[model samples]
Target: MKGVYDIGGIGLTWDLAVQGGRVPPVEFSVDPRVRHSFWALVVGGGSMYMGYVFDQSAIQRICALPTVRQAKLTYALTTVVTSISFVTLSFLGLVAYSYYTVRGCDPFKAGYLKNRNQLVPYFVMEIFHGFPGMSGLFLATIFSAALSSVSSVINGLAANTIEDLLRPAFDRYNTTEKGKIFIAKISVFFFGGLCVSLSFVARTLPGTVVQAAIGFVGACAGPVFGIFLLGASTPWGNIAGAASGLVVSLVLNAWITLGGIMYGRRPVPLPPAPGNFCHVQEVANITGLYLPDPFNNSTGYIDFSTSSPIPVAGIDSGGNPLYNISYMNYALTGWLIAFLVGLAVSLATKHWHEPTRDERLLLPFVRRFWRLNQADELQQAVKLRHSGEHSVEGPQTQKRLISFGNQTSDMI
Candidate 1:
């Protein structure tokens, strides 16, 4: 009776979400801009953080493995785990929506939600509030996860700065190991401080928090993924080609993402309606010109029916249609641009004449191919040298060698 009352009081339909009849079809029309944002999220979310996890930390982790086989195994395991995590989170979102819809507390329609970003937290509270400390525990878990991510970012920044920039200069200065370590420590401190400062600035940055996150990710991800792909896959690629590709990709993607943000399109074609929650009243007794009306700051609901469109960003006053592509597609655009430009530059120039790269530095599958090619070349070289030496050998020695070969052939 207690359990039934609890379930009834909380409006729990725990198993209903899985049934087709109990749930709305999870489908909607998305804006082209939202497509880019979605793609940005997909690519950005693929292996954790694109900047650190893909570029710096993941490589370090891979290299730490005992063998190429182990590295591949690690990647496979990571993929499985991350896929599960993504699916689980997505399902949670669906569960939240379903729960709200069933209870007639659909936040989107009720105009009760102040920010869409708050939906998950609000849902967690609603579901777990009856259970003492569960909500707090859940929040703490989320906070801990965030802290881990920030730590990773700091570590990655330090490692990259040291390896790519600082160490090179320190090497030129004939710095000792201790000096290098000192520099690394300094780099970590500097970057950590910078990150702290930026966190504060990020609070004031214009636009929705989610939009800013995806935009920031889209800005960094495309060019990095492109250049990393080029470097890892192509032997004929040079710094010049990669730099050119990366620059073009970054510039193009940034323009598109920024333009997309400025021209704010709704993801769904049918914007959500605030179902009759608000009623307007005449404010005929307004005193001062500056204080005509007061709006409740806590509300997430806004009526845009009579509001003017946001002022356009970029070259044209109305925003250039050319740059209206979604931010999510930025990664794809940047990657393609970089790869094509990089490949063209590499092919059109002297990169083709460059010496063979270390096969070990590439994927393990390609390593055997390179080794076979090297072995074949070495065998050919040996054959050519033997043929030259054969011409200079005495007739008696040639006869003896022929006799030995005949004997060897007979034994076989």
Candidate 2:
């Protein structure tokens, strides 16, 4: 019973439930600058929204559904579930904070943790110390989850490479089925190694894992999403416009992201847990445990009271404003820049060109209200028949063509 309650508190509420007492209002962000900032949160949300819209896994799953109605329902349900999970995780963070506040101990400040990411693991170990084998089980679970995610990503990349890039070459060379299998096996190993090597590079980057990962994704994925949106929503975009826009956005995002990481102001954390309340000062005095003062120039007795907070270093004081903006803005800015540049370039270069006749390529709203000349419609149908590139295929394509003819006749 004791183990169950302890594990539950640590696992779910993160020590708060075990404490069995009053819980304080959670402080949202340790940094006062970012706390309750509307623009910061909104931009962050925009990044996530665009990410979902353009995510390959999401698109694949949605397309796998048999019906459009089922796809729509799945998307809505996923969003709801995701929102609830996010809220729950957020509350758990609050619980951890409240527990630490009550305990009068800050692990990072106390030198128990070297990195910010270690806090969760440290907390888990602390609570589960009494329960033998449970900690080992928790660790195994974590490793398994991580391996599954990593393997899935690697497999997808390898599969895409073989199917899309190497298939034509293999076909041309008359590569046997077994040879293709061998090549795929080799690709998996190659990509797996490449991924592992990149992880080492990531370890050298500044800031927390969340910031680095999100910033990198924003620099790359944001532009791709922008290009997708441009093609789907607009009629004038061409190859030149998309290429120019993508290149410009990529360069811009990379510059901003790199500059921010290298030269931006570091966020100051909230004040550490009071040493007096934590009895750290008393213990240090009794044990004669003294740490060197980092800031003190004169040789004197070290003041331990204010020694727990991390020293802020490498702050780019009075630097470029663009380089100091929030990381969340990376995606939003990238997307906007790409879309605007693409549209401008497209309009300037191809103003007189005909728009796409394929209604399937456009958004539902755009397709619904679109009207074309009878001649243009007739030309499109003929082109579709020649190209054999109708959105539907086989028998369904013929049915759709007949239905389209009926609709066109009725409109006339």
Candidate 3:
């Protein structure tokens, strides 16, 4: 069992969690100038993108339910489960922190902490070390959960490849059943390999797997969410405006994300070590000592008590605000940028003046806002025919009809 972790004498509390248990309530930040609002934006945006909008699998699963009521019930259940899981994870992290602090074995000092992500797995190993067959079972469970995600990714990629790349490049590839199947297999294999290769790269990332993945997705989430928000909520969301907003948002997000990663980067200052974790040396005891790969940096014990935290970035070469903003804000930045730009573009664009009348294209939840599917004549087209203007298949009825719809537009 992990002992209670404390800095100096105070014990670690769930309220304070892993923030090093400072007396004055230390605020963890990469930069002092970063306000609570900025943190909130990123946290909200990242969470929204990862858990909802960007998670097509989750959306699909919810939609696949037999009834709307059932789907809503499932969503509620999922939310409750997710909240419990988060609490459980937080506890695990605290337990690990306590164990390390009490043992005087700073993970950073013990070696093999390329990124702090390894902490969770390392903690799991220590806790379940002596349990027979339990480790395998736990691993199996983890893999099984991960596999569901993997399947969704592969399916989405394969569909995208066929629709966007393969079918477009070679006509009739998707038209025939045999050709479609072949393309799907090829797409699955290609994307599967790509994802596998990326996993190796993920090992070297500076943050946790979830963080890195979320950051990447967050870069685009803003634009996506912006588009959906506009489409569902606003009558002025034309395709041209939406597309323009997305493009601009993409450029803006890319510039910030890449700049932060490559040039304007600054390592986050870790909290001062608890007790003699840094100054004094300690070793972990286990059947087989946990050894990191040779490429990992060897443990360097730093005297945090004496050394000051690394300074945050001041200004960029272009004299803009330091792009060292946390990746957490990626989605928020993108969404706001896209929404503003899209709104501006929509006001200027011609399409916004005359929006699409196709109610079928609108989301079911938002469909209530759209009064009619088409113009009054087109709207009454179906009703006119149904009242016996002409037979269902007659030339007169077919000629008057521009297209078929349940909502509106029986006439051209």
> RMSDs, each prediction?
10.9, 9.5, 8.4
- What does candidate 2 score on TM? 0.70
- Give the per-residue lDDT of model 1 (tens digit) for 1-412: 2222323432343443433133333323243333333444565344224443366657877888889899878878877886798777766655664454333234655555765667778778767756899889989999898778677777878888888877678878888889878878998889879978977776665545656776667567767877776766765677778888888888877777766665645343222321232222112213322311222324432233422333322233354654555555555666778888887777777534552446545656665665565555456545644877766557755554555445335435
The candidate, 1 or 3, that scores higher on TM-score is 3
- Which pairs clash inside model 2? none
Name the runs in model 3 displaced over 4 angstroms: 1-19, 22-43, 112-114, 164-174, 265-267, 272-319, 351-354, 358-412
lDDT of 2 by residue, 71-179 (tens): 9899788789877966765665556554454444567666777876676666666667667987788789878977886776667666787887999999899999899
Ranking by TM-score: 2, 3, 1
lDDT of 2 at 255: 93
lDDT of 1 at 346: 70
- Which run of 10 residues does model 1 get worst, by summed lDDT? 274-283
**TM-score, per-candidate, Cα-based:** 0.65, 0.70, 0.70
How many clashes show up in model 3?
Answer: 5
- What local lDDT score does residue 150 receive in model 3, on the 0 to 100 scale? 91
Question: Model 3 misses residue 110 by how many Å?
Answer: 3.1
For model 3, residues 291-317, the per-residue Cα lDDT tens digits are: 332223254432234434435434334
